[model samples]
Target chain A: QQQVKQSPQSLIVQKGGISIINCAYENTAFDYFPWYQQFPGKGPALLIAIRPDVSEKKEGRFTISFNKSAKQFSLHIMDSQPGDSATYFCAAGLTGANNLFFGTGTRLTVIP
Target chain B: EPEVTQTPSHQVTQMGQEVILRCVPISNHLYFYWYRQILGQKVEFLVSFYNNEISEKSEIFDDQFSVERPDGSNFTLKIRSTKLEDSAMYFCASSVRLATNEKLFFGSGTQLSVL
Candidate 1:
């Protein structure tokens, strides 16, 4: 069972625009949600993460908005830049299950 | 910032041959995990280890695959009989606590190519 689902296999945005990627999960047991950014030939790096208790979290240009009731969460990139171009993955983790369940990645490309 | 390190960034192995991939997880991190991603595919979990024992594992971790922390500083994944389909990028990650999945530091990964 693919517990987590992601939308928009690919996304294209202009510089200085807002880029958003959404994800939904069925396992309510998940308490932690983390987003990873990966580039070609590179390993996935931790970008930003949030817990169900918090609705939103912002770190510089990256932000995570969580909707606990809907079992959905999203990543928002403000003033998107070309450097932000990469594959983004949303993952959910349960307290008992340390392993993460990753969603199908969304490849984001920002045109300058 | 401590980070995981992997050896032999790329490996080409013959089918049915045994191959071992090594990793050095971040210091002070007690929890370690192994994950793999086939080209153009989503990352999939293989196994997780803690306190010198396997905490969990996925179905993909079968008869051909095994994990060991031979020593305190190194973790290794051995494939007994490599198959063409086994080719993928293997990543090692470590976290501070199982209670919180906050940040997982990952190594660049070892790209395995089965021929």
Candidate 2:
């Protein structure tokens, strides 16, 4: 069974525009939600993360809005740039568990 | 920043052969994990190791798959008999703590192709 589901398999945005990706999870035990960015032929790296305690968290131009009741979270990138174009994945994990459930991933392309 | 290192970025093997993928995680990390991603698919967790033994494993980790920490520094995953469906990118990750909030550093991955 798919624990986490993501929408918009691919996305395209113009430079300086906003890019958004959404994900929903099924398990209520999950308390940590993180977003990872991956370039071609590279491993996924941590971009930003949020705990269920807060409804929203922002780091520079990146923001994560989480809704606990809905079990959904979304990532927003403001003033998107060509360099920000990459595959973004949303993951959820329990407090002490060693495993994480990852989304299918969204490939974003920021065109100049 | 420290990173996980994997050897032999790509490997091609005939079906029914044995293959071992090696990794050297960050020095201070205490937790190790193996994950795999098939072409255009979501990343799936295979197994997790700590204190020289497997703590958790997914259904995908069957009898053919095994993990070992041969020494203090190296972690390895071995497949006794390769199958065509085993073609995927295998990633090694490590973290200093087991908390969900802690970051997990991952290696670039080893692309395995079974013929």
Candidate 3:
């Protein structure tokens, strides 16, 4: 299948807490997975990404845990802060494809 | 850092009129794409361009839509006949390479309202 499904349409997390968002895809052809963060009136910016060859990747407080067998991946934001509130999107793409299959976004809210 | 730039941040057009949304992708990027998101909806892929030609398109890109790289620096999406339902925030993106592993830089977007 071509769809990427993301869960928890909206999430509320307290400051200094951990915020996690999950996504699943049915397309096994997808080898590259990426997460994007979008602020109001701005284009979605690349937050972090992972390849199927690796199980996890971390940059700063952001970590992406990928499950190749389950066709699932998640974004974990450690020490969530008010400034980190935004709409997060998960997307899947094939190795050589030009287009990305995006999931319905998750609106993340961090209350300070 | 280089960024993709779009023109006419907002455009309101009457139904049946033709509208063209313009974008100038990153100077050195070779792959360009157009995507749209209706208000409160997921961002959907419209089309992708490489080597000055379209490489892929989604079902949402109907016969009324066309994409062109008219010059060395600009890529444009044209709607031959606009309808009320065509209103959305259209985004232009570009990547330095063809592989999905490369990150695509996107422009802010052009909000089109077909009235």
Candidate 4:
């Protein structure tokens, strides 16, 4: 299957807290998994990514935990700030593919 | 860093009207793609272009939808007859090369509203 399902539909976190969002996919051909962050009126921007070969990848305060056997992945934001409030999308794609399959998106709100 | 750019932030059209959404992908990128997202929905792939031709397309891209490279820099998606269901935010994206590790650069998007 090509779908990448993400949850929860929305999340609320306090400053200095850790925020987590999960995603699952049924497509074994997907070799690249990336998470994107989108502000209200802007395009989705790359946040962090991980491959099936690695269990996890971290970039600054953002980390991606990937599970190949379970066909799942997640994004963790440390020290969540109000500025981090936005919609986050998880996407999957294969090498040489024309495009990526996106999740429904999660709206994250970090409160002060 | 270079980024993809799209024109006409928003466009309103009546049913049966023709409309063209335009995009200028990163100058040096070799792969170009068009994706659309209905309000509160997941982003869906429409089509992909490389070497001035369409390399792939999704089922959502039907007969009424077409894509053109017009020139070296501009990539366009033309909807010959728009329906209310066609309303959505269309995004343009590009990548320098094809690989599992490459990241895509996306345009802000063009919101098309069909009435």
Q: TM-score: which candidate is best?
A: 2
Instruction: Order the candidates by lDDT, highest first.
Output: 2, 3, 4, 1
Each candidate: RMSD to true structure?
1.5, 0.9, 1.3, 1.2
What TM-scores do the predictions have?
0.94, 0.98, 0.96, 0.97
TM-score, candidate 3, is 0.96
Top lDDT model: 2
Runs of candidate 4 with Cα error greater than 4 angstroms are none
TM-score of chain A of each: 0.98, 0.99, 0.97, 0.97
- Backbone clash pairs for candidate 4 read none
Error of 2 at A19 (Å): 0.7
Model 3 Cα lDDT, one tens digit per residue, B1-115: 7888998899999999999999999998899999998887778999999998999999999999999998789999999999998999999999998638699898999999999
Of 2 and 3, the candidate ahead on TM-score is: 2
> What is the C-alpha DockQ of each candidate?
0.62, 0.76, 0.76, 0.71
The fnat of each candidate, in order, is: 0.59, 0.71, 0.79, 0.69
Ranking of models by TM-score: 2, 4, 3, 1
Residue B6 of model 3 has an lDDT of 94
Q: Model 3's CAPRI class?
A: medium
lDDT of 1 by residue, B1-115 (tens): 6778998799999999999999999889999899998887778999999999889999999989998999899999999999999999999888888724457888889999999
Taking the tens digit of each residue's C-alpha lDDT, what string does model 3 give over A55-81? 999999999999988989999999999
- Kindly report which residue pairs in candidate 3 clash with one another: none
